[model samples]
Target chain A: MMTARAAFAAVAFAALALPASAITVVVADGAPEIALRVGATGGTISQVSFAVAAATAGTGTLILGTTNAAAGSAQAPNFGTACAGNNVRIWARARSTAFSPRTATLTVNGSGNLTSGANTIPLTNFGWVTSGGTEIASGNFTGSPTQALLSFGTTREVSVCKRFQFLNTTIYPSGTYTGQVTYSLQMP
Target chain B: MNPTRLLASLALGAAILATAGPVHAEQPATDTTAPFAVNARLNFRLTYPRFLRFRVGATGATVNLMSFTVPAGNVGSGTPVAPTGGDAGGGTGVNVLVYGNNGQVTITATNSSGGLGIGTATASDGRINYNQISSVSSSGQLPAPVLTNAGGTTALPTLNSTLVTQRTAVWTYSYLNQTIPSAGTYGGTNASRGGRVTYTATMP
Candidate 1:
């Protein structure tokens, strides 16, 4: 009877053997992600102008410049897309166009996005910074060009198109005659 | 099976008992975790002026002054002022700094944050321009500023220690820049002017 009992336990253990080929499957949310390129491309100016540079004997003039130009591209809106997008906008401001005050009329032209209703927006960021302090550019993103009907006061860097232009003079004074205002726009 | 039956099945029961034994532990293994990272970062602030302003005194003034750091970091030997275009002037030698060089000195930047490592290494050279401006007239003022590269070049800084110290090393220098005053509304006399310098620090 005892032998029979032992034999029954052995049979039960053999019946409990599990399968070896089956694989357990699991499901869960993977990992987190981040984006590096978040902003749009194109015009990056709100205003543009010129300055005295200095009261030098031979006064000099400046030509509007663009950054990220398409390598060997030419003309006003020749700037290359460091990254691409259609949102281009720009603007120009002035201090005074008077030659003596070291000012000049600044004409701006660029590609990309522009004004919806009007083609131009004038600037008043001319003259010495302390003389007339103003915020030249802001909230710039994709398309639009700015023009300065006022004066290009001192020797300053103007945000023309999507780059900076350094206008200067020295015949008159050695101090920095900074004047200029330009803005840019692009997809944020 | 009964204990007696199991023992009878053993081939060398007496030998097994003589050669083998069972040992068990009462306690479980405790978790000992370690800290590790794939990458680290250094944290610090870059505080410097956008533009430096200097005064060209009535009489030519000379003191320790600075200049803008060039696009490549060429210690301004005598380059155009900032905003390199428009009216002001270039080659007028107004923003030139006559440096008293002392060779390239060693500079180090360290990050005490996560990495506890050196962030960047740089070299500082000592030199300043002492410019003498002769004219400030309208037609072509700044008569003629003579720049004599004065002061001996500085020597390289000692960097025997590692940059992990968590600080920055900057080589201090002195240079002179001059400006011939414009014919004033007051007197027919001419005065001298001075300049200022500024720089920014970056690390990787």
Candidate 2:
């Protein structure tokens, strides 16, 4: 007959053989584990408003906020430790037992154009630059459904901050234009 | 194999797996599938206020001067007199620019006096009505605002009423020379002598 210790050993071996399957993606403090989703509300939103006092005569100027702040003031997330005073932070991680060189990719896509009632501005007008940890370099929103932001190897964790900017090249209708974008992290 | 050794191996393996599982489960959600994916969203917003900018002659604080000299033989002979100075570099034309991000824009020309006064002469002493000055535009996109003794406003013909309005054109000025009068430099150094026409643009 099998002793108690042998039976326990069998169960322990079974547990060890189980596979690891979990990916973590967090914006600020909001948890996006299972499906890994983050959005423009609660702790995930990053917004800025531009108010121009005079119209430009020649080349267009950068969209500035109060005191001509280039990217506006940074906002603190509701839950996570805030990044630098000028950036929005993003955190992500992927864990698996499959292999040592698993690939993890991050992509961003906008919800069409920014709109204020009947007026609209192209999503491409928005761009960003990132820093700290694994960086995604700098790029503009392409308005594509799956524009790659960055990619990394398996069992990696990234905690980066991004600063957003607006290119005020063309004058659209005078109103508050708003939009949202989703940043997705996938691992295989 | 010895029972003690087998049990020890199983316990050790279980301990390692438990540690890894808790690490993954402690932070975010965990799945049992391959090619796992997650997403996070960010919102953006921009508020732009109504703005308008208009320029005529020159784009500075100092007003421009457009002088016209009628030859003795051409005076009152219905000969159109071109202007000198101003932004046109001795030519009769000056650049005009109008830009606004709201609805249609209206441009008006207003002068302090009803006509060009000659040496403190009263209206009965023969003055040149502002109507004698006419302007022709190089493009319809920014037609010249009409000049009159009573002052008038003209709404810009925008390509789209709901979109931004930005137009540029060259406005060439000419003296109609339609009537002869006892003149002594009808308008000169004095601002009240029709030497300046204030152009104002308004938008809603």
Candidate 3:
């Protein structure tokens, strides 16, 4: 009687292992956004800062964005803004039971903002980004935000909306973040 | 797992809201104002005056001398001669003296209108001296007549001019010799019987 019961308990254990061992992977899709988008009233956007990029969180490989890319430099950057190359970046991370969680920060610098033929503002980054130490490749943030107007013609405040895709660079995975971004005058 | 505590934070009592995306906060609203304005005016003033004078003419004038000498010795002679017509003493009653004759005589003559100064005379004593006499008269109607001492008491203004009228002289000489001088020198037997008379003229 005890041997029969042992076999039955083993069967119950295998059943529980069926679902748990199915090799599940929780994926954090692209969660990119345009926040604190700013510009002048009635004045055109002679330029814009493609400052923020997409973030991704998942149980598998997770990354902020391309490094040494034309959008962002390969290394850390200076926080101050200039009339030239912007210091814009994107970051993402991920975690799992068998792998370590990783985090990265990417940047996307562009030639301000200009309207495309689609009657929308498209970020014009010329595959050129500068940081504290290096230049990088081009097409780093392989996605773009949904074009929208960020202008206030006669009032003090304005509203804008944006979205983007996420991409991974390494095998790093599972990192989530709640944004605490600060917006300040770069070079008023 | 939460970033701070991993598995414990993941197990915390909280609900996980699901969606296809996360929303971000936008930039704060700001104000922008309009520009300024402008506008202006101008003005001026002025003043002035003129200058001028007054004037009149160079109209005309005249001068004169009327009859100032008359005849003595011969009345009606029209020459400056002695008054010898009525009572002889050559009618001047002077016996050739100028002021008084056998008595004092005063002679007065006027122009065509009877005035005071065409001629004058006063005789007395013996021979006619004919020194003191009167002036001439003048008028706005005619040119004054000028006379000259034409040898002795005969005064002719324009000594060659024709006579305009006959002269008349009053004589008191009749009292002297009571008539003509009983001498052969009375004109028809004259040796030189005329005497002098003086005359003067002046401007006002």
Candidate 4:
């Protein structure tokens, strides 16, 4: 009788093992989510002007002019009033949590021309000088027609500062000149 | 196939379902690629001056200083006085209207003859010698005038750092009253002796 009980116990263990195969093991995730934070948008670059009277003669590039009197002298606007800490701040991050590497790149596009009536000023006349804490390389828009602003091997956060610099000039038509620069961030 | 065999099969199926837990919790892997976008734009504008008008008196047609008594003497030397201000004279002040959207205007003065002249009696004699009569002090609306030189180039800040609206620059004249020329009406319509001092406007 004891021998018969041991054989029945073996049969029950085999039946449990058969059901184990029927149990499906499935792994899943909630959903793929990402986040990007860039400072204020819309006319991100401020309005700039030049005064011919105060402008000094320069051989290379044209810049905003300086003057003795406060009236109508050409000087760079205080960009900080509008931007974070007076400089452009760009930040981005992702939460794959899957340990998957993600990429984010920044690109700029525009005619690179500042216009007033028929007059035009090239975008190259001005530049972006990196300031304060920065993760990306320091360079100007003329060189960065399309370049990587930031990238990461995993989830990360970063911040940077950018200041706009104008070249000194002697000549350019007497008019209000304007130009545009576009920044695009892409992630996949 | 007896009742005991059927019961054993049913028990195995029940255990499998129980161990599986919530069926909805398990989800198959899906497409993981997603592209997101954000835009940054730049908009700037400038409104240049519509017309840069220089006028004398309270207002009137633009005119040059005319009809002055020639100092006596062949060498053009006399204790004669300087030319007086006009209705729109620098003494009274002239209005320079710079219509624009932003900032100041840079003004420069240049003479074609190198000096104020009537083809014969040159203000600089042969160079740029002319004084600007202005009421506003350097510390005021306009900077001190840098008188024109013999080379037709005047000192900068001719009207340096002027506001976008309208301001006055008065006018009067003093010439080296020496070596008076052959007496005749020095100027008339389209006379070459009527040297012109060109004023240019630009944003610095």
Alpha-carbon TM-score of each model against the true structure:
0.14, 0.67, 0.15, 0.38
TM-score of 2: 0.67
lDDT of 4 by residue, A37-139 (tens): 3333322233334433332323344443221111111111111122323344444334355646565555665446778766666765565555444456666
lDDT of each residue in B51-90, candidate 2, tens digit only: 7878887778757677888888888888899988668635
lDDT, residue B137, candidate 4? 31
Expressed as tens digits, the lDDT of each residue in A142-171 for candidate 1 is 222443222333322122123333222111
Chain A TM-score per candidate?
0.18, 0.62, 0.20, 0.56
The stretch of ten residues in a row with the least summed lDDT in candidate 3 chain B is B37-46
The C-alpha RMSD in Å for every predicted model, in order, reads 33.7, 15.6, 57.1, 23.7
lDDT string, candidate 3, B1-204, tens digits = 457686655645332433211222222111111111000000000000111100001112211111122324543333333233322232232111111101112222222211211121221222322222222222211112232223222222221112111112222211112122122222111213332222221111
Local error of candidate 2 at residue B77 (angstroms): 5.3
lDDT of 2 by residue, A1-188 (tens): 56988999977875553322112232222222222323122332445454544555223666532211212222222123434445555555555444345666777875478899988888787776654434567668888988987776545455555666677766777788787776777766
Candidate 4 per-residue lDDT, tens place, B1-204, comes to: 889999999999999987653211111111234764443443434333333443333445555443355545423554434444345443333344332323455556654544554554444344222432122332344332444434233222233223233344444444445444554544333435544555565543
Error of 2 at A28 (Å): 22
The candidate scoring highest on DockQ is: 2
Candidate 4 chain B lDDT trough over 10 residues, lowest sum: B22-31
Q: Which of the predicted structures, 1 or 4, would earn the higher TM-score when compared with the native?
A: 4
Per-candidate Cα lDDT values, in order, are: 0.23, 0.62, 0.22, 0.43
Please give the distance, in angstroms, between residue B199's alpha carbon in candidate 1 and its true position after superposition.
Answer: 42
Name the better of 3 and 4 by lDDT.
Answer: 4
The TM-score of candidate 1 is 0.14
The prediction achieving the highest TM-score against the true structure is 2
Q: DockQ of every model listed?
A: 0.01, 0.26, 0.01, 0.14
